[model samples]
Target: MTRPAAPPFAASATDPIRSILMNTLIAPETDQRRPEFPTQQPRIEVVAPLAPGDEAILTPAALDFLAALHDRFAHTRHELLARRLQTRVDAANGRDPKFLPETEWIRLDPEWRVAGAAPGLEDRRVEITGPTDRKMAINALNSGARVWLADQEDATSPTWGNVIGGQRSLYDFLRGQLEYTSPEGKEYRVTAERTPTIVFRPRGWHLVEKHLRFHDRAGRSMSASGSLVDFGLYFFHNAEALIAQGSGPYFYLPKLESHLEARLWNDVFVFAQQELGLPQGTVRATVLIETIQAAFEMEEILFELREHCAGLNAGRWDYIFSIIKTFRSRGRRWVLPDRTQITMTVPFMRAYTELLVSTAHRRGAYAIGGMSAFIPDRRNPEVTERALEKVALDKRREAGDGFDGSWVAHPDLIATAKAEFDAVLGERPNQLDRLREDVEVGAADLLDIPSAGGEVSDAGVVDNIAIAIRYIESWLRGVGAAAIDHLMEDAATAEISRSQIWQWLDNNTVTAEGTRIDQTSIVASMAAAVAALPRFEGDRFDDAISVFREVALAPEFPTFLTVGAYARFF
Candidate 1:
């Protein structure tokens, strides 16, 4: 069946009121160009050259579906993002967030539950997450985990090549034709008998894909929302095929701040399913409760998408960044120490996770745990052993706390994580029955950041500077997940690092070594980090340094570093 065409934007010179409304809702401008196509049909203009194999995924039908999504939801997305900024401003002015009093009835209602798990998602004891490159896709599918989170957001750099090429790779894998040969002649392919269930993660609501402009307004082009573009292209090309194979289109929704955003996604799902002639709830999604605001509204979020909800995930790094971002202006009480010091065992984090487990279990949804960022260092046995011990302990904690499953970055860590879950869930697929009635979390408990006690140290500051610069450099070079100092560093980690630096400097945090962290000290650290790095061929590092300073030291904190960096680099 053919999908319906999207309505055109009000581009006529006579429609002054419609043009004013559109301009007010959308951003000021973007670097998008008009497509060479007839005016009646939807147009998808590509800003970059399509890679050799990109045609397999970016077919005409796929582009039309994407344009339809843009037309339907792009305006809503714009308004939601503007709401986010206004909320932040209110938060900074001491309008602290709490459970929505209006939505309390939804949470109090006892007769509701999220839909049952989709086929192949009944047991998610171990899920490996990474970018969608061909080699990584093959490795993750063969990693013996129950699910592979093919990430296109935090773990991907979103270069035009990476975006189109990654979609091509997923298409090839779904068709059982994906294979890769290394420079040393080693071949890799998916294991037919034990491939993990695929769950795709699109970009967050804050980002935009400048390469694909689908609408024109006032003689300027409008870029498609990145989240819609990713979701539309993937679902258009693969949804029916996945359902035929007994699995359906699954997603991990990232960086959502409110139940309203969840409602938006549910509406999109409804529209997409109806347009494609699929049954309701054909797409199941796991909401990542990674924001401080989202933690308070878990039940509401689930209710908004209950028909299409699979579960909720505890996203650790981004959660930290969100706390800092939401309360950065609240002074020392909200100032966090080193990122390394804030473990899951801390009071605030414990409150967050325990509430998550109880809420998900109560609603008959799976409660997934955070990622173990340790990448095994096989070269040094002691390093590998120590890291494995830490990972095992973390997993054991999550499983014992009633998490149905957990995330790991490397294949080597999967066995270790699964073993812990196996111990807790012997002969059982999950622990969704363990509804912890003892979990009594309040706003004060979730906001008790000061209980995490650790003084910032010189070493921590230097490490933050080093990791931010290093990760941003790799990000600029089109690599999202980089192994640095035996940990898998991605955009979330970078966000935490740079944000901590800004927080410390703004609050005049005194380090353990009797030195005060300030703009001068941070600048010195940045220069030192740059000089200590091994020689690189390109100016990407220089660009990363500039971007890092702009975000970290700005008078006003930018909501996301990736948004600015994407425009600057891509």
Candidate 2:
């Protein structure tokens, strides 16, 4: 006998989004270059939404969606109404949630998107150094970065910059009171620096509690007793300070497990905002969604922090290891794919992405993809080109599949990543249209703002045209400022990420008009946008390119990066 359909109260048809997701052509349009979007009617599929700890409260929207489905079918089968609410007690099967009369709903984990602002060698053509030290920091900022993540966490000059993350320094920095020089020869501005923007990843709760000392009673300093207690302490202190400072830097919450964790974060943010005398709803969040439970609870995780969570990003290696250790014994027989392969081509990644995009788009947030850590080897131009081709294709496919942006670990790769991000975006008018429509239709939701560690910001997204122009404009600037050889270390990695995000636009960017580029330049061009930097006017660009190639492709490279590493994703 066939399994019974759900009761009348349960959705008579599949959710509209699920229907639309089917046959959704996500590939970027080769001609218009528009990424594919879902356009079909909803397809119904049976799924048990409940996981062990999942709880469900039918939101008004879910209720409305159900009503719409019931309206669509006039003479729907009588069995539907009877079986929809079938009790687990009646079935006697243990596969379903034990709780009867409760809708089975396991929220999926949210995906995270890397900001265009944070500093990294891959995103920005420059490297960021130092915590509050201006010369080193500015040198890194001026070199270029979509965003300079003011270090507090992993990239925080582990030794020197550690002090700068203190409440006072963090507060002043966020207020735009910090000063620094730009690599473009501009004198340092005193009040604050904006061009090379910053996103601060706070010290992981564990480290801050252990290492960073704070003032105590009677104005004396003391070591924290417990990391767990210190997590709450540091979070409250720094998170509140940031809110009071009025800076727009957002958050990157790491090592989470479920919606409850996100809710805990949301609770902290709410407390910080209230006590810090800050405006409400100014902050936005980027959830790492790294753990196995997080992946399963994505929908609810975001639900709690609806408006606060701006984007959900898929973390790579860290998450893979997290998954393995979570159930090593149970999954031992089912070995994971090769490390390199897992990084690029995620086998069941679609399930997660679909749930992420489906729920995020359902709730209205940007769906950002994860990182491609490979830095193209320029020694053999072919090696670099081949690596580039693989990820470019992957990113292109991701965008087509509904991701708004992706991450690259190398600064040089930032231009490539952004160019691909923009290429997939197609016309500006269309983008504006989609955003306006989505936001207007009540698509976006955030439970709280100014998420954990203050990582994601409400700062403007780099426009496709802006991203394209910079990639086409700069040439030698990056090569001279930084090295692109291998991103094994965090500094080189940070430089690459920063240059790609921070300082690519100019005062005239909004109004300037020119098509100094074409498809041919994009397709056949193997040159780094930085290679064309104004600083290197003549053979300088070529020489810099040569330097990059020599270093990047040197045979003394990592054993795995041995040759064409991009193919590993596949």
Candidate 3:
């Protein structure tokens, strides 16, 4: 039986006007003019202190745009988040997700294809991912990468300053006005010759931007969705400028679990384009197939966003985290090994990437590969060499598998990644013509967790604890993309660390040395993890430890560590 059709934006049970507002705002006007705003503008309460330059980005008009976005879509976002919890609960209860029968037509229909590469995104052989701070922005734009993932999600700690400052950096960069000077008299500027196509990644639907509160008509107030806040502010401020530059406001949509979520994003794109008086398909988005559930619905997701879809990215780190989280309660078979052991070549991971490439190519979309997290340390030649070798190997594998491009966490690895793609792609912008047809992946192949074939280790547990603590400390200090032991660590990697600990403890996993991973053992390991780190003057180790323990040791697994951390601390 087909699932019942419902309005794209349903009214909240408590807020009847939500549906009316959504219809009025999202519905294309008769003459194609901008949608009329509600009579009483939704009150936007700024809770965080605005820095001196924030006013340029958060103008009255921009805030009004943000408020309208919130008022129209916040209710639907809430529903989707609640649906996520219920789906996870169902998965925990053994209702494992399969390819949707209702959407079988979407998968089987072979003629449908996503909107092919936008102008600047034609040759994305090496995309660099980083936070949008001034120095990093300058370095990334100069990194010789084909694309720069201006990340506001995993790579950015959601401090108010970081949020608004990130927008300012992107705004100035587009206008050729972004530059920085160091205390030691060093200069950094964006050289237009080497600048990459900018693809912005807003936060996922699960997070809230506490700095901005949206007050409804009846004086009801709630935090705005971080996804809308990030997307709205950037689109409102820079859409026209990007268009004038012959590129659109492209995006990397992250952590989507189902095609319905993709549909919502497609609608948002449509509404944003209509509101901004641009063409319907002007904005393009690449969906990250990072969750296990999303793997099942890849074709459907592409179909959902066909008009505005750019392609699909293999978000390898978070994909592993999603597998662990979805099946955490399903017993020992679901337990994962060390984060380092879960490479893209593992059986399930290989299945995921292979399927991603095949599915994307079949749908006429770009099949981007996963990130190489090995950031080179310039001081240590040996470490840098190892990183280069590791990155080359990974990128070579992806290119061989017919991937159009891949991601690198650091500028140093960009050449290593691009060289592999260049060896395969040659003068061609992409290998989209090399459709990978022999790939056949089933649900069982994707769920073959035991195929990973590595043992849980004492050292692995210690590393998980230590890395989680270290990364959390960095996050608390307003640093998101942190280099720990020569590898770039972000929220996705940290999620794997803490979630693995919880899975191990919950399942009574015994290490290879026969030590049962229980609460007592975890406490002992926590001390070792803490002691191993060097002390700094303004470290938030105490709070970091508390946050790690709370999420990792909770009876019920937290959907995302960042959600609670953002709520309680920031």
Candidate 4:
């Protein structure tokens, strides 16, 4: 297949910038090579040079499909992102978020139910999650879990290679051609009798793919939306093959803040299916209820995507980060304790999960639980024993609380998580019949932040700084998910770590040892943390510290660390 020609650019003094916190500015004008214009029609130009394997994924037809999707929905996506900023400002200015009065009818009319699970998604007892690198994709497919969350969102670093290579990985996975060989002569391939169902997660709408620039009809040029690029490429290339294999083009939508966003996605699905001549409802999507704003509009979101909705996943890590980010400017009462202190058993988290289960089940959707980030280590039997015990307890609680399935980061914990769900759902694909009508959650329950009562210790504050620095360094090296201190750390956990630092500094939080969390103390802790880490070749500690300070210690807060980091470093 021939590659698409680079599109022409109108002369400009500077590169265009979408919202800073959302789409972010792309590469500066002087650094890019200009190609001659082919035609006046709206076009997409590949700014980054194609790498070794990118030819397989970035064919001319695939780029055309991406341009079509962006042209149809880019305007609405921008409007929705602007609305998100306004909503955040309102929350900071004491306009508390309550259930929408206008949408009360949607909630009151209980007859509506989402399109249930598709063929392979009927029983998702154990779902494994990881980035879509070739090795991880192979391991996840052969992990014996019912589903593999081929994550490109929080779990991916968004390097130019990863962004395109991930799609290539999935394209190869569906064709049974994914395999990896280590330098030590160990070979890894998909060898399981029954592979897991594949659920691809594209990046959130807030991100922009700077490697590709889109020129609209009016001759305005900006970076392409990451969400559209990821979804467009994957669906355009693999939708037909997946459907023929009895698995539709299923997805897990991340970081949706409102029902309107869900509605926008529904429109995208409708338009894409029509463009491809597929059935209207051939796509299935599971929305991650990761934001506080989304938790309030669960039923409304379900209603909007009813035709293509699969269920909701409790994105617990991002949910915590959302709480801190939404209420960062508020008084100390809205401040949460250390991340270690906030468990699912806390009144507020419990309220959120219970409400999620009841809300999803009431609307005839599967209710999936949060991830257990603990990865068992065989080198130390004691560590493995403790990790398994902790994972078992967490899974048991989720299964007993009416969750159909739960997520595990590593393959070792799949059996434990599946065992818990299996004990509760014997000979049954799911527990959609167990509608937890008893879960009555009010606005006050979800906002009960003070109910999570635990003192902030000096250790907690220091750990936040350490984890943020470590994870940011790994991200800078193009690795999104890193095993840190025996736990799987991703962008969500790193967001929580950095957000807590900002929240603590804003609120003058005093640790249990009478030490105040101020700029001085945080800087000292960061320096110490860096010194403690073992140095490796090509490590990004210096850049990581600079990025961490800009996001965590600055006077103004960035909505997402990845947004700015990606724009600047990647």
Candidate 5:
């Protein structure tokens, strides 16, 4: 009368009639298809880089796609209006290093598909720090990023595969160079070697072009082509070319905060694709809105990149810093903590995630959660559970918030990360008809905000320093911790102020708990920074404003940093 769980214990094919009778009563009522992002006619156009014309020798998928493309669109030219409509702007117009990579060797020109942008934001890719090197990069790749960043920026170490090391890694991946050792201690090899899954994040384009003058043994140019561009310039020159190369990074746009920023990126994509002979809209981009202004303009920024952008990400660590910075300047009650731990609390995290989810899902875009820099202990006895715990917590938060996926640092964690994310994205199906409508016709209002001149100007820098100094000094003197505020010792709002107290414990600039200030490095960095800035006269003018003008956030900077010129000023 009933179906039992264990079939192998008793049943066989002869029970089909019984199985059918049981199925009629107990079949599950579940959606057959997992809910998928609505698909569209492919928007990217791969121009021929070889001899023929607009078609290059196709990969299997490309060949099938090309055949289908010709069959479907051979009668149409309006299909290409998207590429032709790229912004007609000059590349030389950019003035900010923040906007450009050091060189334009590999520019990321993203197109904002109609699916991924919010109502107001256009998709604009900005550069964040490149991620760590190859093996970990493979980890990120399997982690399912729409964009894979091989970090050369802040996330990498100098000795352990930094710029030069990164370049070697890239060329090796590109060339498919690899070897191995046998289990019996015999040196053998892998018969198959493929490029590391993520794209290469070489040294900063500018850093490579300017500083790294590596030569081969014969004193020849390390590169036969001496025409290496900086990050920004290479983006200008080779973005489209990189796309054409097929094996270069598909692209992951980084660190953007506004629609105008997206516009500039779009314009760069347009010019590079057109002038440099790469396919239009092929180089995808993802944006990192890590600053205050970026949060407000999500809709506009996303939509603007509809033609060239990938997806938007909530850059948590940087975004958190930006949020506190904004509050310090704009809120009547301004304060920030010194420790990173206290700063990232539930409330703050919720606010960030809510805004991010609402914005990303509104347009059907992939909501990629931020990174967890938990470098694993390979030798640890309990590594598996430790990793499992880490992934479970992260994915629980991400899945509950409806994220498409999350990122991890090492390949070791890939299985756990994938399992957790895949579990969350269970098969909830939806139809494309309801999702894809022409909604952005008059929605230009979202993109119409006048771009705020960012925090790079002299006055802006001065203001930033002023707030930083006040916060730091308060921590040093122990005034901030006890002052009128809503804070725990661990809160970001206080960590920036109470860190020296923590520093006093272990000669570290900051720790979770403490009662006194470590004035050693604090005094040094503040002194250096104070020397770097303008000094206002005062009889014992050691408070924030004077300290700010002297050291851009004088008291705290030195507590954590060693001696350096930027320690004081630019």
Candidate 6:
């Protein structure tokens, strides 16, 4: 197939290869030039258009390093992913997750501790997360929060442009050359002293970067693992620079299910460090204990990566989605209430968070709280005040309960969340010292879904359908995080919304209004929601509806809506 012409902006750039790469649209193509490598020469074909300035990040050295990573770890990743499937099936079949008897000794051993926090990460009281686009990257780095999660996972749509463009943004940010100019003549740049620490979040193990392919033994092209592609590119390009700037290559691992998965990541870290001639433990990672299975193995996860571990994070939305997913086939007892009703204070959620804090502290690691999804509405003081108040309450709970820090989706909420943490921290950096030995939880506590009491409502169902469609539409447009109804909705939130609809319909869940949720009600609600939405040019409302319905009403629930929806775009 003939490649599309590069965008005008992309062509005007100084770099020749960048112009060529950016001019070529992403599609499956055969590799014409075979390059030599130190050990192996895996065939790599890049189909994505290299956006303007992307050449600086996608250098030959970087691509070679990425290929080396794939050569070494791709096979292990495939095995671990297969293990995840078998484990999920076992969980759904009534084999509840608990602390592995084999790994109990690691938890009991009190002398072991995770490597101390790297520089720029010692005081992460308030961290803001967003996609790694130019404007958002500049804004987030300038935000007063202590850390900025440069997310390439849930907060990113994984479009060809996004995958390459995001790397360019991060590359520029690390080099202190990232800047953006608004149409209104406002210029944004990272302030040296005030810039938040950068911590990258790569895509999860389950995802595959279809635009980049590696040849297998049979000479058939296979999609490269998303995790390796993202992490490899960033680390290969910027690890040395970050280390020189008084910080190491920091990362946040997402959607990990077991300590064994964590072990795979640790092995990758070790290999990457050795490959680049960096010292051992130069990379620091914080694991998001999002999956229900992971919650049961926090200590073991930390233990596996102790030399490279920084902390643990309370991943809220995905955690709820995991609960629904693992127990989808198991009847009503496993069914959760409305997504809105499943707050952190619920018995099961509280148990999860408490356990997380205790586990992190016990292992001498930071325990970061969940994201406060409330985006500030500046037009209405009442709305802003209410949102801030709720945020304050949530932060206060986290701080009081021995959390080291927390996350906020918006820069506006930083002060509010910081103040709450400040009140409890009071000049101290973190609460890792306050080990909550008092908290004891069992499998029942973690699985106590029936205790989160609230009935499904028609409004709740409509909200889910509307948000899922809206978010997916934005995702199709290459925007991962969307501010809708005064809340920031990302892939995680969309997953929870759609998965809840699936679970509800499958269980014949009745709303408080004495109505049973079925395909007919869902169809009506979907139509009504789409109609109520204001029309926009080139909006993918229809596509979003189709994707949502397929995932929510399919005979077998898809692992992730993005897995199926991604094909529509590429």
* Per-residue accuracy of model 1 over 180-277 as CA lDDT, tens digit each: 99999999988758788999999998788988886643344677788988898889889998998889999999999988899889989998998799
Better candidate number, 1 or 3, judged by lDDT: 3
Question: Candidate 6 has what TM-score?
Answer: 0.92
Compared with the true structure, the alpha-carbon lDDT of candidate 4 equals 0.88
Please give the clash total of every predicted structure, in order: 0, 91, 0, 0, 76, 2
Model 1, runs deviating above 4 Å: 1-42, 216-220
Give the per-residue lDDT of model 2 (tens digit) for 1-570: 232342333232454432332213111112322122223312211122433211121233322222222222211211221222232222223222121222133222224322222122122222222233454344444434454444443333322123322333434444455454458876664332434434444443322222323222123333221112222323334454444444453666655554545655565555445544555454466676655446656666676666456657665544554444332223222234223234333444445555555555555556667655556775778767866777677677666666666655444555566666677575431121123222211111111111111121112112212222232222222111122233222322322222212211111111112312232322222344443344533434444344333323233222111012111210
Error of 1 at 120 (Å): 0.5
Q: Candidate 4 has which clashing residue pairs, if any?
A: none
User: Per-residue alpha-carbon lDDT of model 5 for 1-570, expressed as tens digits?
Assistant: 221231121123244433542232222213322122213322212221322211212233332322222222211211111111121111113111122222121122232233343221221111112344444333443443333456544344232223333444344433444232446765433232222224323321111121222222222222111112112223432344444455332334444444555554565455445544666664455566565556656666666666665466666655654443333322212223333233223454555555666566555555567655343555564755665686567766765666655555455555566566556554432111122222231222221211111111222222233335544444333222211111112112222332222222223223223222234534544455455544445322264444333322333332121012112311
How are the candidates ranked when ordered by lDDT, highest leading?
4, 3, 1, 6, 2, 5
Candidate 6 lDDT, tens digit per residue, 236-291?
88899998988879999999998878988998999899889999999999999999
Regions of candidate 3 where Cα sits further than 4 Å from its true position: 1-42
Which parts of model 6 are misplaced by more than 4 Å?
1-42, 183-185
Residue-level lDDT tens digits of model 4 in 149-255: 99999999999989998998899878878888888989988899898999999999999999999886555678999999999999999999999888989999999
Point out where model 4 deviates above 4 Å: 1-42
Q: At residue 551, what lDDT does model 5 achieve?
A: 29
Candidate with top TM-score is: 3
Q: How many backbone clashes does candidate 3 have?
A: 0
**Structure candidate 6, residue pairs in collision:** 6-23, 26-47
Q: What lDDT would candidate 6 get against the real structure?
A: 0.86
The whole-model lDDT of each prediction reads 0.87, 0.38, 0.87, 0.88, 0.38, 0.86
TM-score of each: 0.93, 0.47, 0.94, 0.93, 0.49, 0.92
Worst 10 residues of 6 by lDDT: 3-12
User: Candidate 6's error at 22, in angstroms?
Assistant: 34
How good is model 1 by TM-score? 0.93
Candidate 3 colliding pairs: none
Using TM-score as the measure, name the better of candidate 2 and candidate 3.
Answer: 3
Residue 57 of model 6, lDDT score: 72
